[model samples]
Target chain A: MVKATPLAIDIHNLSLWYGDFQALFEVDLQVKQGLITALIGPSGCGKSTLLRAVNRINERLGDYVRTTGEIHVLDQDILRNDIELAQLRRHVGMVFQRPNPLPLSVRDNVLFAHRIHRADEKFNRRKEDEIVEHALRRVLLWDEVKDHLGREATGLSLEEQQKLCIARLLPIKPTVILMDEPTSALDPKGTAALEELIWELHGDYTILIVTHNMAQAKRASEETAFMLLGRMVEHGLTEQVFLAPREKETADYIEGRYG
Target chain B: MLTERVQLSTSIDLDHRGRDWYTDKAVTFLVFVGGISAIVLIIGIFVFITKEGLGFIAGSLDVREFFGSLAWRPTSPTKPTYGILGLIAGTASVTGLAMVVSVPFSLGAAIFIGEFATGRLRETLKVLVELLAAIPSVVWGFIGLSLLNPLIIDIFDVPVGLGVLNSGIILGLMAAPIMTTIAEDALKAVPDTYREAAEAMGATKWQVIFRVVLPAGRNGLVAAVLLGVGRGFGETMAVLMATGNSIKIPTSPFDSVTALTATIAAELGDAPVGSDHYRALFTLGILLFVVTFIINLTADLVVRRAGRK
Candidate 1:
């Protein structure tokens, strides 16, 4: 008997429209368990839209955002009405394009989602400290921010702030993390540092990162999905897709032609 | 060629002296005058009030009695006393009650307008609130006299309905629309990014607003409430009619009271131009100016602190 591979996120024929402007059309993608999956495309190519679709946050932009799609995260169909958004979000955390640490203390920003999910639980300060420490350490930010836990999170540099943003999601025990251009705002050094952090975090959580940088997509992810306009052109092992692209459009994009 | 180059260098005219430059200079001058006029007018008013009230403060006025004694019998026949303790108490009490009435309603309205209401409803509610603010103060006083008076009497079962309770409710209603407008602006000033961040964290809509938006907008809300309190303290005609214009320290909401603004509005016309009573009233005007200045300063400080954070 053949062994089956586990999938963390399975999206099927996903289509999204912001009012009358359709941004994504009939997109299909599979993110395997415990691996980094990078979605790369030109601007307005719906890569970020697809990442946001996994967490189902695009609908909150406005009621006019209409989506006809099936997005299943961790084998659960998130688009169905029976799913509780709060519960689904607890399992699937997201990092925005900008480093948006809450306007709170570093300790509170990490504790925020944990507190929300565990609202009914008895208060335990020791456990909370442990959670904060573990989450921060997982993002390799514990030593940098350990002495200044009470300081405001927004005051941190963009690189540290982005790390803190990812750190905040860890306490919730999220199974999947969707990142939208996680390093687009970082400097070259910051980007290299963050990529190191992502490499360190692999095999523990399934991460889906969208990036405009093709080099980053190739270097960081095990699997790479190329999108054009609103459709997924190709998705394969990162090395194979970048080295011997199956499609002519994929080859042209890789060669830095028209974005 | 060298002579041509020297001539070209000599003829270089870089100064912008066209009609646009003249227009810019004229506008800069006009705006400077316009801006300075406000400061000049404010200082001029302060100087005039101080000059008018100096005679009383320098001569026969007892500073202690003006603030300490409750006997505000300014027009007494034999021993005319100018004690304003009772008026101070009355004004403070009515303003306090007005704040009590206005804060919840205005904050709730602000939250609804800023967070919940959508599309046509939001615009409609905003326009309605502005319209409410535009209603004449005299009309509000009339509402207090004719509408609220009988209603309070029926509800509270009191012999007379016009008092602190009446004026407080009336002033509260008068202040509420403006407070809502300002509070909405404060909430609007909070970035949408914070709300998005909270929502993505699995916070329900209420949790997002209560935890993130409210905390981020705390200073603006406090400033809004302070501005509302300032308005309540300075209001005149509405309180004059609804307060029944009685000079006494109000121990209860039912007790009739007179406010400082109401006293001046009622008696300044009858008092002779340069009498001791006139100077006393101007002294009250000086006090009003200082209190309002302090309130405005506190609001500015709170808003500036928000900027620093």
Candidate 2:
């Protein structure tokens, strides 16, 4: 008997509109459990919009954004009217294009999500220290930042700041992590470092990353989905999509025909 | 090629000698005058006040008697006491009470306008709050005199409409717009990413505001409150009309009192030109200036530090 793979994010017929402009069409995609899935697209192709939709971050754009259809992350339909945004966000963490660390201490930034989501839980200083240290260590940032945990997170370099952003998400114990061009702000070295970190984090958590860099999608992701305009044109194993792309558009995009 | 180079050089010279150059010079001259005028006015006022009041500062303005004694009788034939303790206390009480009334309400309004309200509602509420500042101080005093006096009388059964409480309420109303406007600007200046990050961290609206936004905007809020305090302390007309000018240390908010501004407004005209009373009023003016200067300096320091962080 063949084993069936459980899906982490099951998105179906999802459409999003900003005012009169439709940003996402009827799109369907299934991201597998404990795998790195990359969404590749040209500029203004709704890659970020689709990524934000999984965690419902696009709702913060205000009432102008309208959505129809369903996005089920870990079997929960997050697009439902009765959904609690805070609860939904706790299940899914996001890292933005820029390394947006709050103007707070490194320790405070790492503790932020935990404090918010688990407000009722009893907190001890020792436990919190462990959580911060563990999260930082997982992101390979513990040694460099341990001595200056009280220093403002913004004081860190962009590379370390991006790592801290990822580290901050771990304490929340999110089921899926979404990255909207997470390494776009970093230099080449930083990008390579962050990609390695993301690869290391695979299998423990489902990560859906959006990238404009085709090489990054090929180098890091297990599965790849290509989007054009507002539609998911193709999705399959990363090697198949990049090496022998099924669609001419995906082939052209990967071959650097147009960005 | 030679003709083109010559033309380019001539055009550059013409650009330097253009009408925009004259306009720039004119603007520079006007701004320079505007900047120097404030300093000149301060110097002029300082010289005038000190020249008239110097003798009292030099001789009879005993620091102990001026500040320590409560009797403010300057017109008495036998004992012309110039003790301004009553005036200073009145100013402090009025300003302190005004801050008590204004701070929380203004902060609430600021937060509501800055964080809670949506597009049009936010803009409209901000404009309306700021419009409150445009209302003349005398008009506010008149409103308080006509509207609030009877209400206070009916509620508390106070003797007259005029007192520290009455003036403080009026002053608070006057200061609210300034506080709300500056504080709203401060809160709004907080980057949207902070809000997004907190929300994405599963924070509720109030939690984001109280924990993240307010902490980031603390310095601006402090500056706003200090500026409000300065406004309340230096206010003259509304306070003059509202607080019945009964020069004494007000034991309660209900008791009538005379602030330094009100004292100067009421007595300076009646006193002879160079009498000790005139000099005493000038001294009070100097005191008010120094106090306001210190408050403004503190506000500047706070704003600068906030920018650095």
Candidate 3:
């Protein structure tokens, strides 16, 4: 079922180790541009670990975590020693499982990433308002929060905060947005709202989401990749993988057997 | 198994107080005593100082003359005029200078320790800062008397080395370790997620610290600074030795002057019991107490505000 679409993310035999214990083993995942791809697995299956590797953010754990092989984003090798991490991160924004808006007003949180990356540019109030309004509108949170734009972002509801987290990344116009269980902390209603927002955002930005919920992977993503025991078991269309799995492990996991 | 269950049920008392209850009660009482002692001692000290100084305040002491005039001659033969305007100025000048010297130094050290250093180096620097805090004020005074005294004199070619400049620098150094400790704790209290989120947005390390962590910890940092100011205000022995104890208002950083704390420290001995001079010294004690109380209260309120947020 190969298509003519160019890949947004191309990973080649990626292996990672935290100190002595390896977390990922020669996993390769190619994510198509302008599509939502979900990585679903049981606990310790290294789904989240694989997502964190795309932007190399897991290295913040210091020199302990070592990575081998290459990760190229939009045809640029991100694993190069001389590459600027700030520039890389600006192009590849992240949304954490728990929504972490900085201790800033809603307006400022939306403008924070933009301001830092474009530090030399001078801006007036109208331009900043446009940027904040544009991003919040994309997340479908503009009308609800427009009146309280000066309110602290943390004071918002969990769903609104999560949407704001995604909005803050939008102003950067990231090539790929990586989300690690973006709905793990939300209630069922909030999760549904966020899934809808993600669906609404497709074709504008490439999305790679990691989730523990198999149903969410089926419901929200066009393509799904299942990992088991730190290895990618299968990658295919969501329907074919869930409805008719080829790998025995994927079939066993989807049917509620031992993980 | 059924018989054992019955026996275990028979020994269990649902409502009875056990060893855990008694231990909890003991700890509660101990904590209450520890907490209340500070309040009680503070009130007791305030009452004692007030009683000692109230007699002079109520009698011939003119409030305007006492606060307005620069004349601090409590021992003038026929007409003793007890004015502390000069002493207040001296203390204010010295403490102000100390804050100027210590605030940036302590804050920079705190940032370095909190955001930059790691592993053994961070641990070692923290231990050293705390050790610096433990050094006796008398030793700091001695350093001012010997080391800074000569250095200041050589630098400015002033006749008197023991003055506001010497003492201010000395007290600033003395207050720095405690300030650094408190400020570092404030920075540490900022959540790590804020830093992670900022870094994920392509912020440099300094940018993350400057924009996010520092602003999040603003209340704690303000409290640390106020605490440092209070420490400088109440410091007696070091200021007494290093400030030259010359009863006059200082016009510049190089002038010799005395602090309110230094005055009380120096004159309380020579003044006879219950004499006006003795009461006047106690009066200075009351002023110092009140000022320090306000400063400490402000600091506590700021920290509590941080807690609420």
Candidate 4:
């Protein structure tokens, strides 16, 4: 079954409502394995909502948010009621617009998920050090933070904080990562550094990102999906979607005629 | 460039010329007075209590006898004894018991109200718990007298129902509402971003609360518990009505005793005006004041530090 389908995430006819208001209407998307995909749209276009729904994080917003239809991650039906959130989330990680690192020491922040989900599992100092070093190095933060592993994660700069947030998710070995405009809070230098890092991890993990910057989508993603007013307007190869004239809405948005 | 030039040329002066200036100054003066009133009142109370309490301690009563000896016979004709050791022990034991009873339950209630409950249910639980705070201390005392007193006697098989145990239970219940409110506020004050981040990393509901929310709000939680301690320490009428008001150090929770606040409340009405007995009661007031002042000061420091973070 896994041989035939190379998709990491598949969504079908998904509709979401926030109380009386509908945020997403029959949105369908397919993210291939081992590639970076960007979802871009205006502020209220439900790009972030779509990203949140992939990992079911939107359920925490409140009970008023109602969702229907199916989301499958790595061929597992995640929308089913019996699906365990902890297990589902272990396979699908997320990064937010703001770098919300736990108010903990750098090492603890990296090991938080492993510590909680594997509560009964015992780890020696050597194993813990290996885990922290491996995860931090994956995000290229080990060099900057290795000397001060015991210091507070909140004390790091905004760029390092975002990288640490990404590193903290690595120990769980998630196959799919959903980023909700992860570099929005960083400066241009931080954004470029993070984009480079994301590019480096291009083929090892499937990444779906929500962004408002058209330039970021053009620069970073292999595939891009455009949404407007809770509908997926276009989905294609990043270059083709940007250059070729397809839908009028997509062209107008890409040409900067209107948001 | 055109817009910038227009904006620069058409800037409005915020410094109003006539009555508006006076209005701003008047409002500022009122706010200043309002802010300083609490400090002035506290200092006034300190001055009055210390002045009245200092006379007997300086002249007649030995410092050792006042603080060291446990015998508390203050009005005896032969030899008047005024050691407050017994009273201090009573207050300490009852406050300790109150903390033991209230902290766990109040924290549990706070977690439930802050994390688990939905909109209507959350609002309902909050209103109910806050209503617990609005219930008068005198009413709580009466409840202890009529309800808890009989229950205690039946359970422990004690001679009189009033004791450290009964008063401690009453004070704990009375303070739980306040503790829960403060703790819930602390828990809710943790930004939603932390919860989302933790949840996205596959943390279970309880794990997110215990590991992230609770630690982030630790200062507030400490402040809540300390404020509850202060409230328990300063509680007067409930302990007065429930504890047997005996002037002895209690060996067990079941034994009758008089808390410092109870001692002052119970004796202040009968003591003659401008007498040594009256002054000693004021001394007990000073002791209570100092302990609660220290507690409140620590709580303020914790809150301020948390704010800075």
Candidate with best lDDT: 3
- Residue-level lDDT of model 2, residues B177-294, one tens digit each, is 9999989988988899999988887788998998899998999999999999999999999998888888888887788888999899888999898888888888888888889989
**Alpha carbon lDDT of each predicted model:** 0.91, 0.91, 0.93, 0.91
**lDDT: the better of candidates 1 and 3:** 3
True contacts kept of each: 0.67, 0.72, 0.91, 0.84
TM-score of each: 0.94, 0.94, 0.95, 0.92
Candidate whose DockQ is highest: 3
- Model 1: what TM-score? 0.94
Candidate 1 lDDT tens digits, A11-124: 999999998999999999999989999998889999988898888888787778888879888778999978888888889999988999888999999999999999789999
Candidate order, DockQ descending: 3, 2, 1, 4
**Clashing residue pairs in candidate 3, if any?**
none
Clashes by residue pair, model 1: none
Model 4: per-residue Cα lDDT over B1-309, one tens digit each: 355543456677777589888899999999999999999998998999999988876767788888898988778778877889989988888888999989998999999999999889999999999999999999988988999999998998887899899999989999999999999999988998898889999999999998999999999999999999999999999988888888788888888888899888888898887888888889888889999999999999998898789
Q: Per-residue lDDT tens digits of candidate 4, residues A131-216?
A: 99999999999999999999999999999999999998888888999999999999999999999999988898899999999999
DockQ each = 0.74, 0.74, 0.84, 0.70
Q: Lowest summed lDDT over 10 consecutive residues: which window, candidate 1 chain A?
A: A1-10
Error of 3 at A166 (Å): 0.5
Residue A236 shift from truth in candidate 3, angstroms = 1.6
